[model samples]
Target: MTYEPELPANSSPADAASSTHKPLHHKPVAKAIHPLNQAANAKWVPINKSFITLTRIILKSALERFGLVNLAITLRCVTQQGYRHLILVNDDRDIQIAAVGRVEEFIISTEMPMTPPAERLSAAEAVTFPVDFQGQRLGYLVALVRNPRVDPGDEIQDHPSASDIKYRLNRVAEEMVGVIKRYQTRYRAIYVYGDQCYWIGNSAALRQLDQRIDTLASSALPILIRGNKGAGKIIAARALHCERHTEIVPFIESGCHEWEEDAATSILQALFAYAKGGTLFLRSVDKLSGENLRVLQAFCTQRTLEKTTKGHAESVDIIFSLSRRDAELPASLQRWLSINTVDLYLPDLRERQEDIRDLTRFFIRECALGKEFDLTESAWQQLEAFPWTDNVEGLKRLIVQLSARAEHPLVDRPLLEGLMVSLD
Candidate 1:
């Protein structure tokens, strides 16, 4: 929900939005505030700052900067009245735009069942848009309207018809494609790899890690990414594959403990097939049994072979992930592979309380796409004070649960207190 920037020209948004869980079909969104609008609405015209200068150049090269396409998409969807507008291009037929307006209506109505029938119907009428951004027919729009209520003599005037939305969306899509092309040509500063925006305190350990990932990506060594659960190990692995030296192939990952020893061959075969000339991420390698251990060991020994074997390609890179940094790897395997290690340890939400607000802002915007949910100052304070043992994932769960149950659009301290007390 909290978007840092866009992906490179070679990557698709679907690839960028990759999650293990099936992603619910939701409307595409743009940024909360456009850089263009922010410049226009500033109180005083002072000397331009560096970010502002970059923003200006980015705007000038909107069609070229990969990040700008995402920014532009974010800006459009978060607009006051825009109901889930998608940027579609005639060139890209793989993109499919979901209808979020109806889904939002269903969620709202279901959440507020106690409202008077008249008011409920009135509320429904205002939000129901009849147009959608459908990427078809050199591209156009489609929509679903349920029981449009019209007064005796009144007419549905000034409403955005399907064609109108199609025309506007098509233009935006074309603009986005142009923006993507431009980014590829100019703006060398936009570093695609080792360029992740994250929340980390000014710790020497964390700073060292930031530098290490960049260096490690250049070498074709065995990498072992260690991190706590929910610490974004998968994200790190994906970032590694996107580096310059690696060929763009499907990322193959498997948890060592999840499969039994007998099932190792089938799993390895599947992984070897998926990661053909790409990266193979063995998550929780410490849990592998006697059988799977040998299979891995054999692959590493193949380095001594003079000729490239049928399946053993030099381009195939291997990465491992473990939960603990100091945990001992099985001694037999340790001698064979030198895991160019990266430890991704983030402080828990309670430990880094200052970041809760930023994280909350991110979660709020994400939930708001379906329903209106606001957090009072006191509510934020309550959240900041709580012990978030589960870190970011736990906070997300709480917000989603609260958003589903809250009576008002805005979440106040009282609502949070009531929920917390009930849990206690």
Candidate 2:
């Protein structure tokens, strides 16, 4: 087992020291200098200059950056030539060995088969820094010195004092914490809607919707989505499937209008065959013909029966999207839904008017492609007051038109009004 640096909230210094099999201060001496460290020393680059360069790289690769690797590399380049091991622990209690200097075997042999405690632990051999953002603890960063000749008991005789090492490690840990917080903030704002990707709204309704989607994603039950046209039913379904399964599970989609003819059986058979061990999304399921309805009913019944006895049989999960304007579902379909499916009702844009500003900002950002723009108060009011018949879909189209026609970075009331008149 890999050893972590965390300790219990109530753990004393004695308990923390005993958790690790051996003290962290002891490390095997280096036979030869590492090439990277040697090159770094030759240039004699200032620590602040190297830190600034590393920060720029982290910002540019924000989305793809791994915190552990970035922190490890930065610490190794800035510190003195000694064996250094960097360990990072995440909020989920997952431990990552970010970097191991020349003496990897010595570090592994000393720290393996130990579990991290819940609280922070420190020893004379190593230092542990708690990484926090806005007062919330994110993780712990531990750095161990690898020089075996350095005496833990007699620190005054050591050439590079332990105080110097601690100070450098702490500074590097602070920079790493900032990068992690920024990455998390960006991830929460980003969202995808069908082919168009935009930032998500922060309204209460949107938060609830996200929570509901998360709960439904992990279950095997059928899903019945009811919403107005262009209210994002299909997007929700796709998001649910993507979150639940990691592998490339085939997602087969078909419109019920396509099955209005007599060839419904063949189309459904092909769809079912394609969707085995995956998901089948039926668009406007209420428009299905009587024959198609019977076919679906029988299919659901057979699958239900098979699931009862043969637990390991491959089954297709059905997701039905229906417009609120459509007629009530047939009694048979209703029974199947009631017995083995969850119903999700999406609110139209008009119902959640508070989200208009955030949704507009997201669309504007997508259009600008990182260019900054400002919307006037009156322009924002105009957007929030409008009755969005097409829900989020209509709002997106309007933003695209505004982006195309606006001559300046400032989107004022008059410019917005002029565009609205032209679109009308």
Candidate 3:
């Protein structure tokens, strides 16, 4: 059954005995939260289940400050509202008749919504809160109570009951909008000269490559990254351009196949002008002809005598990418563009099996936001068992399709089986 908070809608007869209830920041009883502890900012105060004496001490202090004497306070479980009770403490900080009254009201509202008031009240009194988290502040949550006789456990109860709490949560969500925003940057090391590098994984190969990149970024040597097709060569090139020590430079990306004789000349001239004190990434270095390679070599090796139409030559850095398939080219060609080659052996999705589960979970969470569906364990298992030929791209499409078809709260085995059958 759905649950709710137990609390009074209006001040009870006992409330007439209390005065103000302002929380004080400084007193002999006031203690400081640990420095750098973000948890202290949380609304719910932390207390151990066995710390009865500490609980009493804090409660007594709050009551004295609130000028409470004869008022009866109550604490009761919020259930659907929370995992624990809203600890209602009187102005005098005593948890007494109010707790019983609130718990009874909650039971009446949830279990016997249509029952007569006398029968519901009797049925409610039998239910009680086993634990309390709100401490003495439960009484202050008056804004959450609706019925004139109802007493709530905490102010942040379920919807309608905790309107104030919903407002607070909304405020928090709004303030956090741009705080976690992500951005992209591309840079080249002094050695490679390019940028566009954001990768996630804790593999040993990647760590070693990161170290190499750091060292290379500190030097002026030419660097080459050799990888397989779609192996993130462009990503590496962009990362090289975004080095911290270098000036914000233009990153020129040009493929060898995109150049004819005149086009290549014009592009090179334009690049030289734009790439002064920056980086130029030759996306597929393997596509350059022998004559063009020689010309590129001359351009890189030369010192600037004066600025030409293409600007100063000595300040620009060059990075090249070649696929491993192209790396096995004629020995004569290797000599033409040979420099410090860094092999990037990108693992196939099958080879990185350990990442599949985590990656799938991430993709599901990303795709399911604002959706009513969640994938069942069996459905996820089916996805995990399938052999993906297109790697991450294929997995993304499959997830999108599955999410589009989901109607229930979870994409169960039946849904997945049907999807798999259709695909096959």
Candidate 4:
């Protein structure tokens, strides 16, 4: 049985009038019957059973664990629309109404249409928005306004007021699309390497980083990720490798500062062997000695030459991370980086302050498990005001600590202030 909202016994005048007119194509079906009754009806038994089973699966799955249903309901409420339909299109181009809001007694077609209706509704003049993610159209949201004004066919359009309505509708649709796409994307737990996942957020910096990773992932050139300490450069590097290479390749990581001059060459040789047909991530390369830097440069040059001449399919892709802004390398090393590497800069937590709330929520989910705490307005202001010197790592640590001592359901100003003072 398809679930829909309940309607009042004494309907409004508008509802009575709408009920009088039959829909353009199909007659309105009987008020949604109980699942058992739907099963008893021979014609609808298979379809109804399948739909119920699918809904139960989705409800239990991780896809619906997020706020997809809540988002649809919220969008419908915010728009003040009497009817809202969210349709999900699968890989095989099959479309199904995944969710609906305020559409209790409406006509629903039994058969799937051959093609989805064009973005605009012609009969009733409703606007449709495509829920797109990463250039792929996953589904659409159609919101129908009650008693919509008819569009007159004219050579020149003269409706000035329609523009404002269109703008508001477009804005709401955009917001709904964003919410859906964010939940659908695997940004929270992207596979990075063996037994590790990168937590990529929805901040603008990370969005740009995702784009850069897509652009440079398949290239043979070196990649240099620059950021402050604890700014997730290493995670970004690993995510890039996971995204670009189709085959499972080894990820060999080393800290350049850990290598002494005498052992640098031997260590690099061993790393090269381990990193064949895969990625080699060098952390804190800015701290390497001049001799060690030269050794790296020579290795890179040799690999580049060998790849060009021998067509080695097992060449290693080098990725370097620089934590300090003022760190300098030798002129030759700098020149090589400039010529052979793609530089990606990750902004500090202070730069993307808007992401603090989302990061806090993520940490709460991770650290608190079932127990949750709400942050008061003043507490949020305090968090925003403080400079995150250690970036996301520091924020996560603070959240974990706060969740441990959360006396009240809400984290208020006094509690946050005390924690901040203690940390200082």
lDDT of 4 at 277: 72
lDDT for model 3: 0.43
What is the alpha-carbon lDDT for the whole of candidate 4?
0.54
Candidate 1 vs candidate 3: which has greater lDDT? 1
Cα shift from native, residue 388, model 4 (Å): 0.1
Report the candidate with higher TM-score, 1 versus 3. Answer: 1
Which one wins by lDDT: 2 or 3?
A: 2
lDDT, model 2, position 385: 80
Better of 2 and 4 by TM-score: 4
TM-score of each: 0.47, 0.53, 0.43, 0.59
Model 3 lDDT tens row, 49-136: 3222223333344334332221112333333233333322333543343443333222211112324345223422222122222232
Scored by TM-score, the top model is 4
Q: List lDDT for all candidates, in order.
A: 0.45, 0.53, 0.43, 0.54
Error of 4 at 302 (Å): 0.4
Residue-level lDDT of model 2, residues 1-424, one tens digit each, is 1112233354457745554543332222111111122111111122343234444443223212221111222222222255222222222332222222231211111123222222212355444555554344434445444333433443333344566655655655555543332222222213211245322443446546655766787666778888887677766666555545433355566666655444444445556555666677877877877776777777677776776665322677778888663448889766766787788777778767877886787788887566677788888888888777788878888888887777787889987777666434
Relative to the unseen true structure, what is the Cα RMSD of model 3? 27.3
* Ranking of models by lDDT: 4, 2, 1, 3
Over the stretch 1-424, how does candidate 1's per-residue lDDT look in tens digits?
1122223344445644542233322222111111222112111111113222333333234323211111222211211134322222222432222222211221111112324345223432322122222222222111121222433233444555545544544544444322322222111112222222233232333334434555577664567776655455665565555443222244466667765544444445445544556677788887778776787666555632522454435346677877554558777656554543334443334556655775676676676567767688787778988876566667777777787788887788877776665433
